[model samples]
Target: MDNYLTKTSETERPEFKIPDFIENMGPEQIHERMMASLPEDIDKMPGGFPFDYTMPTAAIASELVHYHLVRGLMAAFPEYAWGDWLDLHAKQAHLSRKPANKAAGSLTFIGKPGTVIPKGSMFCTAATAAGSSIDFLTDEEVVIEEEGRATAAITAFEAGKKGNVSQGTIVLAVRPISGLTSVTNLEAVTGGAEEETDDALYRRIQMEHSMQSFSYIGNDNDYIRWAKEVPGVGDCIVMPAWNGPGTVKLVLVDQNGEPANEKIIQDVYSHIVSEEDRSKRLLPTACSQLTVTAAAGLSISYICTGLIYDKDTTTLEQAAAEFERAVQQVYSEARESGTLIYNKVRSLITDLPGIVDFETFLINGEEKNIVLSKEEYPVTETVSFR
Candidate 1:
């Protein structure tokens, strides 16, 4: 039996004539021709190439060639991606010397002529570092104190669910809207102003609601919890955080459209504004505030820790992205405090046992291969089943 095999073409080679354009072309001309042939969107942004034209065009051409080759390989399998095939090929190459499947157990190397044998598996060699794995953050020392406190509050509410289900018990409160906190009565000197007019009351209520609609009172952690416990409480939660007269005195209605608990509503309203002030007390030391204060000084990373709880229907990816965006917005104000700036995001995660790889794809002209890259992120997430 033959120990080695060589590739040979079964069909006879045909003579071909070169066109005038083809014969006269130099490397630059060849590159220009290829570039001209690319899809219009391929070279454009948003819907096009990521890099600029300054990068050597040949490098881009090489990438396209590599892509085409991968597609061609994928097309052969019709069911497997190029990455999958490459992984299988690497494994097969490893097993070839082992005596498990042997009509002949001797080793054979298949590669291009004049090429040196591979030192290590191609897939293994090309594998990235535990670049960005979920596990990378499994041990990340991130403390989501705010989120934890929010969770604890929710948990406490959930546990006492049977005790207090009053819509009044879960009142939504707000601090004065920062921009339009106070409104004055225009009828102060009106001759007929002893009693409030219905029209006047309606106008004030509409103004307060409008102000609330435009203001952000930070993440509405409490409102979300209250809404979950009581049905139709979403409207209650939508009330303005404005400090209007009789606003604090206004009755919080029940599900039947009657005042549920006016005293509790007022207390909740007062507490909301008081709580906002209390939280703001930390502003002197707040990372965001410090970023603003040090605008002419330090190059500091205004880091705040946030945790992603499973309670929300949002995925970890979505939560992480949102948190990252929040951080970026905060960090943008600190840009004058440093150079070479970009927003950095780190997840506060905890725990990993069973290992799973994230899916990665390698697409070739005719074949697409799927592979999993091992997880490796710098941040370790704290783990707790409870």
Candidate 2:
């Protein structure tokens, strides 16, 4: 597995600053406007709300807007139009936070199997920034209850902290853009009418999920092709962990406000279970990243027969080995079929023997495989044919 790494330096790159929640404003004034976004109760409540719950910093607010904005961009504009933005922004914006003394951002990515990342590609992380302070009110008790009625009113201040950041970066330098699809489209399918048999409904659901997954990938490819023509953009890259691609980090230089304060966006990956677990055959995992959830996608492993029947009475270990080999061969072919494929890379066999030799199979000729086996093989004892 030969691999190379690429890093975008701030010195060489142009200004990619995430503009302050408000451009060219002093903190005092910006603070005043930010207070307006707060709930009215803070004014009424003696002890105001906490910062996290009450006031959102300019950077924090901007992040909310930026993520939705990008999503809107991806949704509203054609892939070509969206690509134009991505390409232009990658150069003009920071891939990560600005370097020391340098007012620009950069990012690094490790190229993986079958792909080589190119230079000047744009990758971006989108999400809310963390660690902002909100003007809140807190109650201070005074000894004189009635005489003083003295409740020392304190500004209920809540400090901003990063929540589980789930935003993934788009790296357009490793693989062609066509390879990456926003899984946001593969939504769950509704179950069929009551009259439909379980088999028919299950089949329909599986097929729909597969089709939607394929469609997402198809759209992503289109997105990449469109991005290629944009100025200042380079080739796109797709990563294994499917938050889209690349290793870019988006940081909030300052919260949106007149005098925006510096705050960081909490990392989102920790909260999301990576698609890596979706590949296991026995362990059923949901594809949260995929827009669709009702059924397994193209490279899914589905249950067929719950019993492992080896007429020769082969040992479970032997049967399992052979089954695994067969499945591996199938996966190789599935990868070449040019269809959307989803496989969970991380899975553990936990369930006990439910159905003997019940084997799992990959649907739609996808590049996924499974195996089953029995515990014993019988020797020929001149048995009579039935």
Error of 2 at 49 (Å): 4.4
lDDT of candidates 1 onward, in order: 0.25, 0.27
The whole-model C-alpha lDDT of candidate 1 against the native structure comes to 0.25
TM-score, one value per model: 0.14, 0.14
Across residues 272-355, which tens digit of lDDT does each residue of candidate 2 receive? 223354342211133223221111122233333344444565544544433432333233233334322334311211111221
Error of 2 at 58 (Å): 6.6
Lowest-scoring 10 consecutive residues by lDDT in candidate 2? 255-264
In candidate 1, what are the lDDT values of residues 230-265, reduced to their tens digit? 221111222222344212111222221222222234
In model 1, which range of ten residues has the least summed lDDT? 97-106
Candidate 2 segments exceeding 4 Å error: 1-13, 18-21, 24-53, 56-60, 65-386
Regions of candidate 1 where Cα sits further than 4 Å from its true position = 1-161, 164-248, 255-258, 262-267, 275-386
The numbered model that scores best in lDDT is: 2
Name the lDDT value of residue 301 in candidate 1: 26
